[model samples]
Target chain A: MSSTTTTRPNGLALFILPSALMFALFFFLPIGLMALMSVLTGNPVVMPKVAFTTRHYARMVGDPYYLEVIWTTIRIGLVTTLVALAIGYPLAHWMARIKSRAGHALLLMAVLAPMLTGIVVRTFAWMTLLSDKGVVNQTLMSLGLISQPLKLMYTETGIVVGLVHIYVPFMVLTLTGVIGRIDERLEQAAENLGASPLRAFLEVTLPLSLPGILAGSLLVFALAISAYVTPILLGGFQIMTLPILIYQQISANFNVGFAAALGIVLLVISLMLVIAYNRALGLVSGQRELQ
Target chain B: MSASIEIAGVSKVYDGGVRAVDAVAMDIRQGEFFSLLGPSGCGKTTTLRMIAGFETPSSGAIRVDGADITHVPAHKRDMGMVFQNYALFPHRTVAENVAFGLRMRGLDKATITAKVKAALAMVELSGLEDRRPAQLSGGQQQRVALARAIVIAPRVLLCDEPLGALDKKLRQQMQFELKQLQKKLGLTLVFVTHDQEEALAMSDRIAVMNGGRVEQVGTPTEIYNQPTTRFVADFIGDTNIFRGERTTTSTVASALDVGKGLILALPPTEGQGTGVLSVALRPEKIRLITRTDAATAAGSSAHGIVENTNFLGGAVLYRVTLESAHRVLVQQPNAGTSRLFVPGDGVTLEWTPADLVVLKD
Candidate 1:
């Protein structure tokens, strides 16, 4: 038994070697190279010189254009998170309340159907629906609600719409796991204690599912901020987010150093927000226990 | 103030054609501690839920204080329920849980605080108000559940196996405490449990159910001593049942001829002709006497040899086989002055005719 126990860790290390090598090669190496490239200065046509300079970082901070793109990205991320939560919560509650197996399966398929198609394909579908003379505009114009077609394309609203559609499923899946864990008897008990159905949900079910809401919000916000395809397709060049600006620096201007600096800034801001969220949750749960 | 409840001809049929509760009808008096005692899947919980307004019956109506509440929504029924698992809100503190119903009723701040304190004090949880349900022991959580239910002064309090989750010792203690609380507060309570002893100890009257139907409803002593059905006799406690044919009947006595030349005397019963009959006798009712002493007993007696002996704490249970090879159980007090019977001892089991209960199959 002692010999086998000593050999178990070595066997585990051997089993993990292949995945560890793959992660280091494909993930960490590129991030390390990017960090190195952010601190060096060189032209694409000349041999690169390794010199430590803070010029890229300075430009990213001092320039108003980069600051505006950063603000826009944060705004879009927050809005998308809010919208997805608003839509996902009721859908998830409906799914969890379904008693029949066939009904649950049908609702589950509907929630997951958007994920099967490519993001690019879904973005194109949104573009067609939001453009001028599209289905929404045609129906609204025929109903005489609007004299002219609304310009939904090439705007922040159009971008948020696309991002919410793409990421709402993640919110629903996370919330479903937590909501399904809540016992139905708790709600029944609340109602039996003079609480109406709606009041029972607001007082008991909502408070118990706060952890799920936090997780789903964090996931949706991170995905929304880092998304590139849907934002670029839906908003075109009118509304530029952080990821779009990073793409522009690398492809159009060939400024890899500046692009890497921007990427680092985005990562740091996301990390700070996550930390703040976790601290707030800790305080709330602590108060809950003491109460 | 508490109110009486009437469940009239109630039945529940699930969607796939399963009758979870048959036509069960019973009236619970005001301030009475009533229990629905049965085994699992015996529809006791379903009947309790229907009274709580959580389930609508398929046929009959439920009346509380002369008002039909059969179709009323659960929230408007003005009742309090304690679940089997003690479904206390984990997110809420004990004080908050106890104050929920009062708050929902639009009670003012001072009134709510006073009532919450009073309720918690009644359950002996005066200092643990701020602790969450997860922080308390199982028995403490049960107290919190009871406090939450009674604070609203509901018309009826429904508890579905509230003490089922505790350890055996704690369960016994809680059973006593619950009975005391119900008596002091004069609250009408409908309790559901499968434990026969708990029901017998706590309830003023018990409705013993089986297969979605009520087998009998009577006081504890009546149900134990004069059970009218075979199911009720076997379900409530241990008994020795003898199946035989009635050979003779008189105004004063009746004789049942069990197989193997053994005859048992029974009291005269109505509608029971000279045909097959079943007699149930409690183990404690039979006395094991020596063969020489059995000859003087005026009642009927059977000669048997002790097959096995089980020493309970205050009593001894003896399994004996008669000369005709029929097994019988006999229980006797283990007093120091009495002689103990061992295996292979020849004895006679004697019982008077009045002790034999004739039961319907």
Candidate 2:
């Protein structure tokens, strides 16, 4: 309604203004404060920062227990990524090949329905499924496959299963977005060029879908590595990961500086893995020049 | 080796009870450059796909080289197809794309390399083997697709509007090259195209289709000049259709008494007297003469005035309003010796009975 406003050349900039402000306020501000807290002395959340110290970083490097926790955290992320990929690729490919729109929509709903539920509720559902007296062990026992009840809860396996249940939707969504866009004629062309159906998939569809795999795996890995609630509830003090250790420092010990330092370390590790994975994919994918 | 293909009454029906292809049969000889030409959704591409084993006929069969291949999977059928979009492997290098078929067959490394090199050379894309498909222009991508398909040396090659994406000049060039390649290899090539001119220019025989049915199958000359159906006549090129009831005019000649006081003389070869006769007259077949000289004309003649004149680079088309008020189109070559008639010039239209093709309407 103003003359100058109507005459402004960057009319499109108004659309991004709100999201840009929110991102700067909610994302960049928190990360900046966390980085600052990692360096400040004492409990910075409740009390004013008095002095700066490198003691938290020194303590983390000096402690072998912290390093092991980071390594285990990375291992869980890698395993979750691989498992999600294994499950998601087939589902994604099936969704891509489905001829009917209703079938595609139904399958998409089934894949994405779990993520619509709360993470805590999903973790609880997995707990009931994986408990020793749960339906899984009951069914296996009824089938006479296992004479003794397997210890399914409070272990790395239980934690991983819960993490995958919560994060696999992201993988499927990413993969489907990509694989669905690939031209079907390419595979038909491969088959036309004397490739069997399986050979056509391996030679044409697989390499073309590699970028999707990388993107989906990276998304799942980031979420899996940073996850705290599911690991805490499922692993039940038996499994040690960076998020669990950071939670304990903040909730039980009230060590804000140490908690912030651990959070920064975790963020750095995730960033490093993302960069390394991207580099590895660049070598395999002809320098990431996708159309 | 080239192979003959026999489509024995093949039909494809969809879930909605729509027949994409309806009982189409054709005997394609070995080493023939055959084309299925039609408008969109006329079953041309579907027929080609059925021959390539990409689609299954609902109630009929297809054979390749006298062996039934209707139930065979596409990979085992030994046919190479060039898709409209080129469909090159975006991730692979040009050389790798060309070598894919050879690798699938488990050929020796040296032989695959040699064949890939030869195929690239054939398409005039020898030096761009290391470049990815995204790095090349559309014409270059088309060449890559051609090289990839032909390097396999399959029994037959299928092209589904392959050059539809290219510009006009490039499409003509590729059309010439593809025809030459088909001849050089002596391979059976089934081409599907909606472009009638492209089909006429490249195909040894063209099967014109409309509404899920084949209207006619013949050489380019026959399809153009002697169209059997009204659809074929109208679809292939521009034509003036004259429809009227049969009447014997004074026992000397049988003439079709069209509306508006126009009578089209029937050829002597048309013996069967029909209830209603329909004929297609090409625009180029009619001659334009000044009304003062109209008395010297032969065959069916009419007096008209030029209503409009269209100047093409190599030809002139005149839309003449006849004495009966029926509009007739006449095209003449701009050979620079004959006077080009302008609009409002009085003219006489002349055409022999032989120029009128009786339509199976």
Candidate 3:
């Protein structure tokens, strides 16, 4: 009996031990070390001694530049989430209901083409399009809709557009997954129950697709809050966010202690937002079951 | 509370070169529980959808309450429909589901609540208004679907096999309940079902559809007792078919070409002797009697050897092989202590000529 029980746990260990080891090595250990470093105010290069101090956190809260960066990060996340949802819902609805296989394939290709392309390549393409002498400015100028080159590049508008382009696919994919699972007969039943098409959409389709909207919004918001590339390329030091600030503090200033404190603050806020979002949607229990 | 529906020359040719519903016309009178009964892939469902304005008829018109509603959208048609799977919105409470249509019509909050309560009560689900569809059992969800349809007081109600998902006993109960509700509400109902027994038991008039066309339309008794075509006779019930020639309007001399062959005298018919004719006798109509010879039995009697006997609790069913090698199904009620025939027992099958129905091939 002891031998059999030992073999059974060995079989269990074979399946679970790999992931447990990986989590400890790649996730929990690093997070623990990082959190420990957040409190130490000494040089990180050699035997950094632990010293309890909230000075870095206090400095972050008091500095106008850091506060502005935090506000800008949250604002960009909100704007990107809202824009992606607005475009994703209708596109996902169309994909879910169109009966023709060929049409569905075409729509799928359209969504996948941009997503499958590397993020850097897509961002480069957007940069060109938003450039002063690029297609957008030239077209607008030829159409008499704008004066020469209108200074559209390296602005918050450019950053938001690029962010929306990158995150729209995520929102679309999530919404499509949810909307596809909805039984279409409910919409037909709503119509037969004397609801107009618009009313039926509002009362039935919209409410049923809420889970998709919430999930997509959370995903896009998280990605947008942590974004580094698009904002750096487009904001051009004008729109400073926490990631850029953290990178400068660590790499340029070599202020690892201050950077670690800022990193801990950002990580805590992101984790809290994720937890609150899941709780509000009642999706935490569902996600746990899936895990 | 009820409205008549008229479908004229309705047809649906799908994009895949299939005529889902051929040109068909039907009129459902107010307060009538009409059923479209057919096998799968038949046009019954398509016809029902056309009436509900879900599918636009390819070449014809649909009118509800004397208005041409062929061009109107489904929601504007003022009709109610129940799906086979009971398409209740899973995200909403029962009251919210029932009140959706009322809210769409811009009804006030008080009126909506009162009507929602009344509709829930109608389906015997008054206390379940706070429950979501997923929380209810299959039967309760179907009732909620029914209430959601009727809450708006639509002129017509269309049901596409609403009880198709339930077990046999539950289906039977729902059949009775739905029929009772239809009668009680005086609502014109166009129900679609493939189960012949369900059509027979509930419909005021049954339209038996086949391959995108209506084959026959009649009361249950007429459809059972006097099916005009071979398809109708074969589809409705079990019967013994004997091929024959019509000697007259009511008499058919057997085509078996034997001197002592079967002959049937059927009820009167206006049209006769136009084609190959056959007599269909119900299994229960044939009686088994023991006699010294087949000639001693009353009415038309045939001699045969019992091939198999099945005791079905209430009745004894026997498969009898005639001398011509044609097997006839005969059923006899089991009453009192009696001699039950074994497989090899010689028997005489007797039935009155009036029990037979002559069908045109």
Candidate 4:
């Protein structure tokens, strides 16, 4: 080999260099810009010059509109997470327990079909089923359960319902991976120790799958808090969230700096919540043996 | 709790029309360390699972402690099990894993803690209470599995090749440990394994299974030395079998005519035809004799050439091929330093009729 060619980078560096450069450009640069903008808080009309200030952060803390939106986001995220878990745990258990290849294939199709379909298509399908003239309302009315068609769309209920539908597959797939790795013998061991079926589930299966639960909740909660499309389609005009407000600030008002500030605030808060969750759960924490 | 397992003509058929376990019937005594020994797909594991109440028998009934528990679910059977993979909950600490059964049974926190400590100490893992299963080595994990199973003080203990996953040395150690634990606790243990040495070492009584059926049930020595069938003789250990026909009292006459070439002589057995007998002789039971010794005719003998010689630590195995090209193996324990024979040497293999075991074809 030539001297120049022989002096080239090692194999690992050649592989890692390209992805590392791309990550720095697309990820760290935007994060840097957002961080700088969060500190810059001048109304462009009053001061055209780019100046740094903390007024936006102060306003974010003091204003009831921003506080209300944050609280609403948290509430929706928490409820959506809990509801997704309640439904996904059993479904995931059923999927993992199937012994036949065909049964497993059918289950995988059930979970993956909706996941692979377009998100807008799924939301639109739910829209037809949940509308005032939807099948659900018509069935209830014909069954004499209601005098009139109940308004099932354009409310917090609709938002949560849509979010849960969109997020439950995430929980189920995560749980399937975790539950499948668990040796079924532990559950059998529990059963043989005088635990009833329900007791074994509660004590063995549920607790053992907690890592999946934690991961799925973190993912759903993070996604729910920043959800823009579902709330816009289902929550109508009343439920204003941080993402919606940020979108309005940027697109309608053409306030790039303000939008960046809001984005930074949301990002910081979400990261803090993730860190707190990890700490409380006593995650790996550099403790390799515990893992 | 003391319990005896009586499987009355049990059979298990899967949905796809596969018979996993055929009609299997056996009685396991209370507090006995019984083994279901067989090759894979021979229904050993299925039988173990059926006795543990994990799998329901399709046709017959399973009575535990003389009570029919065939239809009862696994959890209500009140047995305890250790698996080959040592299924300790990875998320729980060792103490928590041991205390799981007590907590499920509604024991108080103090009692659970005390029992957990005792159980952990029993497996010699006293200080590993705070460690997760992933933190422990494979052997330690197996001990934790053992502690978890015993902490429940179960009615019966089921071990499905509990030592199969361990290394050879560790497996030997754990085998002794498990046997000692069984004796100390006086607990009924239903073990499953395909290792013959393991089965011979740890079992109080062994049920040799094949093709989803029990071939024989006996102690280790009986299974090895008194095999009733050809399959049993070949499976338990090495043996040299020859085809013969009983000619007189305690003598099996062979087709090979040496005027003195007798296949074997044994006690009379049950069979109708021309006394077609399958005679098995252990390798070490046959002796190598010199030409002068064979000429004297002091013992029943066969003439053959030493085809091969293997020096194994304190024993030597000589493969003797007769003029008929029939090979017989003779193993002799070496009390001195040198071997008595070499390859290509002519010798007479000698053994008395008493050493032969007559097997049904």
Candidate 5:
């Protein structure tokens, strides 16, 4: 405990100590080190002397290739978030309304089954289903819908599909918790007030679940942007997101400073998204209660 | 604009063969405030829900204004219901909640606004329009629920213990206000409550239910004084029940021999010499006097000692044990000047023979 623990009086500082320390070690310290590295003169290899420079940040700003990489990363993140939300929202509503405990548990288990597998394994599973000679192409060819297999791998679409498969369970779980917190009788009251079933759902349930949609979408977007393994394995050499570019700069080109610069850019993007999420959540929750 | 509802032989059988409402029937006249009163799991709520179209009866016909609505969906029934939790839309402001029913009916915006204004005024919730349900207190939320339901001018208003969440004082106040609103609107209201006192105080007529069956349905006075079933008598208030065979002590003295040495004289009322064995006697009807009169007082009386005393502020209830080991409950009003007895005091419990209600077995 520090001075803050005694000052808190309720011991909340002590209660949050573990998570704060974990965040520092896993996030804050690493980001701090990377920020220092981005300005240092030398690569990780042995150097004669160390000097401070802004070459990496300048290169990232002026280079067209780097800007394209940033845009591609944003596009993939947006598409993946949209797809996951489209598939997760209705699934969450249905699961939240399940009256029986066993049925709700079974459906939740089905949603979480993909998450139970490791990310690499889950990516490979999607690879098997999406490859040209795999089940998807084979079924489409046998059904005569196409003369040849579509290019499903080593592309941005494949990377998005893979990232969506990885993060949809997260989106659904967040949405389900929020939707479950909403009272079911609100919809009943709507129907009793003479709204039809669809109207009641649209007016009552949809608006109440807006907070969940916002949180889930932002979560998926953040996860999608930060994704490394899925994009590298699925997009391969055909795509260059910020993470893939950063990996190439660090490993193949031995540019540690440039890798740190890219890491900072990615961190900045995530921070902006988090700020937007908080503001939007505040607007919604503030409307629900008095100051 | 009220509609009379008739439910005939209605039953709701859930899965696993549990009968929540079995052969329940009621004929609710137009503009009447009828209440279905019972303990938990006694089918009062189930009966109310079936009439609201939230539940489809397993085998029955339900008619509103002589038109069968048994198979209709909940939204199409055109009845307003105030849930126990006062489930106002949390995202909507109070004004929006009140305007919902009017908008659903496709009323013009001007008419919707006026009716919403009037509805809020009726519930005394005007000018809290911009606040959401989360911002209001429990009683305020209840009023908003009532405003939301009644704004539609529904043919019937259904309330599922809407006042159950409020504190005791607030609940009583809402009870009076709700009854006033019902009378003013002439709503064919069907209210459900587990509290016997609340049901008795507010309802024009009440259906006393037990074990998924309506034991009796009548006005409050009739149900309290002349309970046809032993369950109704016991459930409505505190009373002592005697079960035995009916016997005559003389040509003019009819009595019920309730086993042991305790024989209770029966009043020669409407149901005399009709073999009605079991009887119910309310605690407050019996008089408690000192036993020092040397057994001079006659009438139907018993000698007993006070076993316990419960002080209810306005009344003192004494549990007296008779010589036959039969306990008799007697209640005396706490008039500050009256003689107060402790637990060890010897007393005589006396009542006229007519005070005993001959229950149907």
Candidate 6:
């Protein structure tokens, strides 16, 4: 027994060594390089001596254009999260409550179908639906709802629409697992105590599904803020989110240090938001229990 | 407040032609404790749900306080239900769960608070108001469920196996407590359970169901003492059933040919010109006496040999093999003075003719 117990840890270490090495090589190395780059003063065109400097961080904080881009990214992230939640909650609830297996399978397919297509392809599909002289504008003009085409393809609203469509499936998938675990008998108990069907749903089903709502919101917000491809394709040059600004600093200007600084800032902000979101959820659920 | 319920020819046929309840009918008086007792899939819970308006009967109507409520929705039926699993909301505090029904009725905050307090106090869970349901013990959660249901002051309370989740001691204690509470509040209650002892202990009248049909409905005494069917007789308690054919007819007695030259005398029953008959006798009603003392007994006696003896806590059960090779069971109370028999002991089993009940199948 002693021999086997001593060898067991060795066996575990051997199994974990491969993934540990891969994580260190692919993940930690890049993060360490980015951190070093963020503080170094150098020109990307030539390999020069590195010197310590805070100018890049200061420039990112002091620039009003970068601040505006950060604020716009955050605003778009928040809007996309709220919109996904608003649409995902009812869809997930419907799917969770469906009695027929075929109905549940069909709804599940609909929720996951967009995910099967590449994000770029889906964004282009949205472009056709929202652009001037596109199907939406042509249909609206034919229906006499509007005489002129709306400016929807190159705006923040267009970016939000595309982002919500891409990320709403994440919300639905997370919430389905949570909502499906809620006992239907609790709703019946509520109704038996004089709550109507609608009241029971609002009182019992909604409150019990809060954990899912919190998790899905956090996931959507984090992904939306970091997203780049969909926003750039949909908003064109009219919108400048943080990711777009970072992309411009790297690819257009060859300012790798500034790009690394922007990436670190974005990471910090996402971390802070996630912490605040968790704290807020804990407070709300705690208060609910004490009520 | 309590209301009388009248179920007239109610039946529930599910999709694909499965009959969950078959034309069950019963009248429950105001402020009475009634039970629907049956095994699983016997439609007892289905009958209770129909009255609670969770299930609509496929045919016939239900009337509460002389008003037809067959088409009414469950929330509008003004009934309270306690589920088997105690369906308390885990997200809400005990006070909030108890206050849900009052809040739904649009009561003011102060009134809701006062009533919630009173209801919690009634179930002896007053101080645990702010605790979540998950934090409570099983009995405490059950009390919270009871308080939540009764806080609405519904017309009739429906409970589906309310005490089925508790341990044996807790179940017995809660059964007595629930009965007392129902009496104190003067509430009409419809309870459903499969345990015959639970049904006997709590219900004023019980409807025993089998195979989606009600086999019998009667008071506990009548159900135990004079069951009308073989199912009720066998289901309610232990009994010995003898299958035979009626051979001779007399005014005071009748003879049943039970094979092997053994003709048992039974009381005269209705429809005596029967082809086949089954007589049920309770084990407790049969007495075992020595073959020498059998001459002094004033009843029909049969010679047998004691095959086995089982010593229960309060009684002893003896299995006897009669001369005709038929096994008969007899239970005698451990009165501390009766002679105990063992295997290979020759004995005579005696029972009054009236104790033998003729049953249909």
Number of the top TM-score candidate: 2
**Reference A-B contact fraction recovered by candidate 4:** 0.75
The CA lDDT at B54 in model 4 is: 87
Q: Tens digit of lDDT per residue, candidate 3, span B1-361?
A: 7999888888899988899988788888899999999999999998988888888888888888889999899988888888989888777778988888888888999999999999898889989888877788889989988998888888998899999989989888999899999999999999999999999999999988888988888999999988877778888977788775444422243222222454445544424444446777888988887644525332266788999999989988899997557788998899848978989998877777667776766
Compare candidates 1 and 3 on DockQ and give the better one: 1
TM-score of chain A of each: 0.90, 0.90, 0.89, 0.89, 0.91, 0.91
lDDT of 6 by residue, B285-356 (tens): 988888764343332668889999999969999999988898988999999787689999998888887888
What TM-score did chain B of candidate 1 earn? Answer: 0.95
Residue-by-residue lDDT tens digits, candidate 6, A1-291: 787667534656788888999999999999888888899887534865778889999997898988888899999999999999999999999999898788999999999999999999999999999999889999999999999999889999999999999999999999999899999999988888788999899999998888899999999999999999989999997899989988999999989999999998888888898898789789757754443
Error of 2 at B108 (Å): 0.7
CA lDDT scores, all candidates in order: 0.90, 0.89, 0.83, 0.82, 0.88, 0.89
- Candidate order by decreasing TM-score: 2, 5, 1, 6, 3, 4
lDDT of 4 by residue, B327-347 (tens): 888898987865579888888
Q: In candidate 3, what are the lDDT values of residues A52-148, reduced to their tens digit?
A: 7777888988898788888888898889899999998999999988999999999988988888888778788887898898889999999999887
Candidate 3 Cα deviation (angstroms), residue A88: 0.7
Question: DockQ numbers for every candidate?
Answer: 0.53, 0.64, 0.46, 0.47, 0.60, 0.46
Give the TM-scores of the predictions, in the order they appear: 0.93, 0.94, 0.90, 0.89, 0.94, 0.91
Candidate 4 chain B: 10-residue stretch with minimal lDDT = B250-259
Candidate 6 regions exceeding 4 Å error are A1-21, A43-46, A286-291, B249-253, B258-264, B290-308, B320-327, B343-346
Native-to-model Cα distance after best TM-score fit, residue B9 in candidate 5, in Å: 1.6
Could you arrange the candidates by DockQ from highest to lowest? 2, 5, 1, 4, 6, 3
What clash count goes with each model? 0, 0, 0, 1, 0, 0
Q: Please give the ranking of all candidate structures by lDDT, highest first, separated by commas.
A: 1, 6, 2, 5, 3, 4
